[model samples]
Target: MSLTEDAIEKIIGKFGRYQTWILVLICVGRIPTEMQLSNVVFIIPSVNYVCLDEGAFNATNYCPCKYPEYDTSTIVSSVTSTWNLICDRNQLASLAQSMLQVGILAGSLFYGHVSDRYGRKIAVLLSLLSEVVFVAISAVVPEFWIFMVCRFLIGTAVGGTMLCCYVMIIEISGKSFRPYLPGLIELPYSISYASLAVIAYFLRDWRHLQLATSLPWLFVLFYYWLIPESPRWLITTGKRQQAIDLLTYIAKKNNRPTENIESLVIKIEEQSLKENEQRYGTYLDLFKTSKIRVYTLIMALVWMCCSHTFFGINQYIGRLQGNLYLNVILSALILIPGLILVVIGSLYLKRKLSVIISFSVAAISLLVFIIIPSNMENATLAFAFIGQLGAYTSFVQVYLYCSEIFPTMVRNSAMGFASVFARFGGFIAPFVVNIGIEWASITIFSALAFCAALLCLMLPETKDTVLLNTVAQTEKNKVVVNQEST
Candidate 1:
């Protein structure tokens, strides 16, 4: 165990009041992030429309009218209807959604460096602040282009907030709690996702729904005072005093003695300095060695697959043959089983096996959905839910698995690197959905899932392993595993 982990174990005894507070704060903060990410489902829902020129309409022939009449029985108003994003302009809706992913892609790359160079606290705070500002702007922007810009900005913040917050949670947690805590972190996501459906149901107007989602983030902004920088990050950055102070505070919070905190922090600093001297910890270091390179490549692929299917299914919810509101709720709620699977996997299953199982389930479920007759709407929906469950499970598992596999020095960067591809997958999801062929989209998702599962077999299982602090340690683990296999 690293000195920081040892000190935390001795001082806080693992899951304690201090860690509990951190978990709750970070997890609660994620609610708004999920809200903003998933709100697109309601913000740009599908609508039936006809040309405003009644004389041009007939049973067999239709005219392309610049002015369109929208049936707003379900959605009072949306970006689609407000701008008449239909017919030739229908691609604009997908573009708006894709813009958010583009922003997130940029943010992931930007914040990965920021989180590592600055501190997790600052990255998270800045991201949250940006999310609040941009989302509110998105709610009120009269011009579609202005709204798209806001969405892109919001996506950037979302990417930063998610990456940094997740790293902070893992850094502060103990070994026993580390794996399971990530699963718990996903609980708020499910809550926010389901709640958004209800919120959108009441507030049919996209702007009102956007405001409802954006407003709750104001409360999360208060986390500035509640959350602290990761002690491990402090130690690695050569901030011994800050690490000592933080560990002392944690010790006091957990009702443990602070007497040895300083000594522990000093020891951790020395070890970190030695490790730092051995190698320059940068994003490039991830691919410096063969084993690490293989791990990085496989992780990137799995993340992309997970995001592709997960977001594709989410974006396609409106097109499903059912009540849109109910479909959204059911889709969000189906994630509960996936979350449960994550918890169970963290405790009993190996990380590699868990990921493989989840991906396989997703692929098989999607294939079943494809085979189901088109007229059997309920059966198809059931299969879709199953597919989503598998995708959601794999998605959350990858987060935990990725964190465990990477060293602390480059953990955030590794996540950021993989997230770049994930965002790319998400960025294309709307375009895939817009293809207007449901079976074709499902085929793509299933193929990706199958490939991801197969690739996962190449990764080393990280369950119950200590989180490494340096690339050298990771390579050492690889050597031991190879020796054992031989």
Candidate 2:
């Protein structure tokens, strides 16, 4: 029925060395992007201002000048001090930070199409090139408006690169190995977050820090020559010759024979035929099917909640208690254990159950904070850290789970479409925290987190299930299961 089974085995070996190297390259590419996303944490200024007009201060015996200069000794210069975005202009700081997420939202939608149409490798390379140029430009922009523009462009590239790299890694690896790969991929992100703290500690000047972050991407520029185009993507796009060439190269590199090339070509052709029969999938396809539509809606809501909570916590990490640098470092470092546990649980526990537990823990931690008096600094800080651990775990698990749930044809498209909502959540998270802290209460986050956990109950368990290539396959798989059980 399918191409000879043995031939398929030889081509798509079980989590071999070649795949491992590809994984490493993709993970490394993620480092600078993650670093830049959080870089604004350090860039936000901590400074005290003094009135510039001596006459106004002298007459009133109170500081009245809104455009006062700042004391730069305690801190190296920042955008806040440099631009005088203080007092009446304070809201601009948060607005600037949110703009990056806006670009990310656009990039995700654009590049997902690029990856599905052109290929993952090209999409990733284009994103990296944009990052290198914009990141460098962002460091030198003389005005805040121009800097914001650069930040937005960089955000676009970061968003696209993140999605393409992740989907490509999952597509290359075996089903049994898929769960573990996300954890490994996340390792670089964690290390980069911690490294940002260290880097910021030494390079206090925002310009210097920006330069440091931008230069590391020079290495990422070479990925065009280093990384391979995803064979799975090529097969979907009807590039059988390209897929065969890549697969043959992979087999050779892994010391396997290519005598099975005929079978592999036949298999690719069979898949392409099925894909053509189904008609082309569009963004609307994600919503047309009832089961998939429900799953998409649920996952989309959870992704938004997870992103909102995760970035919201990051914005406040420095305000928690101890040294700002140490607090940020600990916040990033705390994710390591949570991520490892999620990876392990993806094997033994149900996917839906694990995600629900993770989100519930995060929600409960936030709720606990509302009850504990703010004066009890130690307890509040501990709960905050616990909340971060839960949010980070869920964030990583959702990515892995979505990869399994969506069919190959529309996987990136669905992810990209969903990311549009997630980025909107991120865009609003800072304002929610900032305005909520001033107007209502921070407990609002607790309620949102709880709702996110509840949404998890609606998703199906995908653990140990094969990744279906099309919606028709999913329906067929369901029927086959019913027949087998009876």
Q: Could you tell me every candidate's TM-score relative to the true structure?
A: 0.95, 0.92
Candidate 2 regions exceeding 4 Å error are 1-10, 52-64, 69-74, 275-280, 436-441, 479-486
lDDT string, candidate 1, 1-486, tens digits:
342245556655667798888888777766767898788877787678766566766312133666677788888898888987877777898998889888988898888888887888999888877887788888888798898889899999999988888888888877777767757888888888888889888999988877777776687768878999988788877787888888888878888888878877777667656655642256788789877787888899888988999889888766898898899889989897778779988888777888899999999999999899999999999989998888888998899989988888888888998999999999999998887687898999999999989988888877766577777667768654444234
For model 2, state the Cα shift of residue 279 in Å.
7.1
- Indicate which candidate wins on TM-score: 1
For every model shown, the clashing-pair count is 0, 0
| Candidate 2 CA-lDDT value | 0.76
Q: For candidate 2, give the lDDT of residue 444.
A: 58
Least well predicted 10-residue stretch by lDDT in candidate 1: 56-65
Q: Write model 2 residue lDDT over 307-350, tens digit each, in one string.
A: 88888877867556667778778888888887789888787787
Task: Candidate 1: count the clashes.
Answer: 0
